[model samples]
Target: MKKNILNIQGVSEISKAKQSEINGGAGWGFGGIDLSKCGCDCAGRVTGPLYCQNYFGCLQVYTCNDSQES
Candidate 1:
């Protein structure tokens, strides 16, 4: 049997994020979560725009799994 696995990391710099879509309401507006950037080709999930304080304003984490066996 043979198996293959790979790990990769990258930093995506975005000029601006898409504005959150808010539903009309009387008080607070319920809206979708905001992201700097996100997408995955494999079985995976997007984790964060976990806030940061300085020049790097936020982080978006993508964890993916693509494997094959023979």
Candidate 2:
């Protein structure tokens, strides 16, 4: 059987406007993790901070032809 994880292999940023909402709020958006902490460069390129748990490997910045995780 083929399993579809949908979008499990990626990260997402909370909407800025929603960050100001009265909910849990975008902690990461506010200042939880910076681009560098997340291992992304100026253009969101991965700087190899990724720890590959998979026997294969996680996608590189250029592997997907882009900086964004997915």
Per lDDT, the best of the predicted structures is: 2
lDDT by residue (tens digit), candidate 2, 1-70: 1234434576445678977774552333543323334444444354543331211232354333445675
Q: How well does candidate 2 score on lDDT at residue 6?
A: 39
Q: What do the candidate models score in CA lDDT, each in turn?
A: 0.35, 0.42
- Candidate 1 has its poorest 10 consecutive residues by lDDT at 50-59
- Model 1: how far residue 47 lies from native, Å: 5.3
Question: In angstroms, how far off is 68's CA in candidate 2?
Answer: 65
For residues 1-70, write the lDDT of model 1, one tens digit per residue. Answer: 1122222245333334433443353222444434443333233333344321211332344345636687
Question: Model 1: how far is 21 from its true place, Å?
Answer: 17
lDDT measured at residue 40 in model 1 versus the true structure, 0 to 100: 35
Quick one: RMSD of model 2? 15.9
